[model samples]
Target: MQTELTLNERHLYLHRYPTRQNETLQAWDAGDEYLINHVEQLGLPPAQNIVIINDSFGALSCYLSKHHNVTMVSDSFIAHQGAKANLSRNQCVAITHLNTLNELPSDTDLVLLKIPKSNRHLSWILDKIRNTLPANCRVVSVNKVREIHTSTLKLFEKHLGTTTTSLAWKKHRLVFSQLDASPQPISPFVEWSVDGENYSLKNLPNVYSGESLDLGARFLLPYLPKDERFKRIIDLGCGNGVLSVKLGQLNPNAEIIGVDESYMAVESATLNVKAALGPEFQFEAKVNNCLDDFAPQSADLIVCNPPFHQQLAVTDHIAWQMFCDAKQVLRAKGKLLVIGNRHLGYDNKLARLFGKAQLRQIAVNKKFVILQATK
Candidate 1:
């Protein structure tokens, strides 16, 4: 994939985090280029306090940090890591990084936003921008033209004020808005419950399937293994810690860990697991990219519901990476259990990683299937 980003007649090398040799995707996209070009065209003064939201990598940060004081805000651990790596690779000046939960820097002079896939997440961010930034601060955003609907523009106008869009360039568009609205209260966490369980789940705006238990999780809940042999377990890509909570209930002796990339997801998971299993329970939630830093051959069991998409792009690389990581982290004879949509063909991928003889089907339904792979 393309690694060189040519901005203002200068080239910067960028890569996605957990950089893979065979990776075929680039770190930056047209939206990033459009924003960079727009900023260059405007000729903003140096040393401005700029806040960049949801930069997929260091594309905007690395370019802007050269002359501006940049602060990046994002929910993704991977994106943060990517930005750091790319910035260092290009020897760019260091910049501040913040998670979605952090308050915006009070002295912000400009905001550069990359529109996210989730409307709820966009709304949450817009609300925060409205509540935090000065009224005169200019807010500029970028996204694929196809992704920006009337509703999306209305969301910006509703939270901020007087939003408008530029003509499409390279199938991407730039959004401009003024922060003229009064500070509005941020939305509360969404709360829901399983049909017959007493457990209550609370999800931050960006957590996957936050409003309700998704179909795959609903189908796999009843079939979660209750074995005592599993002592150390991980819920990979644990969105709201629902799987970890259930694992805690089933395997009381196991040290349950919930791992996800999103800060909001990790926070929601921690809160949900604590509420469901209590503070005394042996459970931990972490924000990480898959099992990147996990110990080799350490886990006794790994229960995963891998995500099929990264941001707005629908791809199976995440699931493939999760399976690869699971294989490296599983101890001898340790098992990995996964639930995925049948069409995703996770069974074939698991078999490829674990060998045909080591993989087995645990359960299957109309749309979902549970597979087990022993190492």
Candidate 2:
């Protein structure tokens, strides 16, 4: 994959966060390039306070920060780390990095957005902009032409203001919206109870399966390994901490930890776990890239519902990396329990990582499978 981004006679070396030696994907896509090129052509005055939302890896900030004060907003911890690394690698000016939960800067003159895959997330961001930022701020967004639809544009118009789209370039398109909409109350957190369980889960806007229990998780719930011998349990990619909460109930003495990349996901998980297990429960929800910072052989049990995609890109690299990390962190004879769609072929991947003899199918349905691998 290309690491150098050449725009306007300038070159910036960029990489995705937790840079992998065999990474096949580039840090930025055509949509990112389209947005950067369009902004450069506009020749916005220097010193303008610019807010860049959902930048995958700081491509927009790395380019614009040289001339303008930039505030990078994202819901991803990994994306923020990537942006920071790329900024340092390119020797770009230091720019502000803000999580999605933070209020948009009121002084922002321009907003550059990379439309997220989740419309709920997009609506949440647009709501923040409408409620906090000035109505005159120009919001320019970019996405693959195939991803944007009439419904997507309607979201922009409904939450922010009048919106328009540019002609497709390189299979990508730009959306322009004027922030003229009246401020509306932000949506409330989604709350739901697990089937046959009294525990209630509260999900922030960007949390995975926010509206209900994920189907895979629902399938895996009956198979979750419960043992008092599990001293340190991890819920990898824990969305709303439902699995962590369940594990806590089964093995009350085990310390449960939830790890996810999204800031909103981690926050929601933290809240849900606390609400379910009480404030004194031994639980921790962390925003991280898989288990990159985890100590080797520190976990006794790791339960995962691996995601097949990151942002809008459908890929298996993340699931692969999570499996590898689980192998590194699990103690001797410790187990990693994973649930995923059958077509993802996680069984073959786990067999390769943990050896065929160490992996076994715990349960399987028509659509999903729960596999357990022993370290």
Overall lDDT per candidate, in order of appearance: 0.91, 0.91
The weakest ten consecutive residues by lDDT in model 1 span: 179-188
Report the lDDT tens digits of candidate 2 across residue range 1-375: 899988889999999887889888899998888988888888888899999999999998999999999999999998999999999999999999999999989999999999988888888998998889887888999988899999999999989988999999999999999888777677659887899887988888999999889999888887887898999999999988888988988899999999999999899988888888899989998989999979999999999999888776788989999999999999999999999999999999999999999999999989998999999
User: Local error of candidate 1 at 144, Å?
Assistant: 1.5
Residue 250 miss distance in model 2 (angstroms): 0.7
Clashing pairs in 2: none
* Regions of candidate 1 where Cα sits further than 4 Å from its true position: none
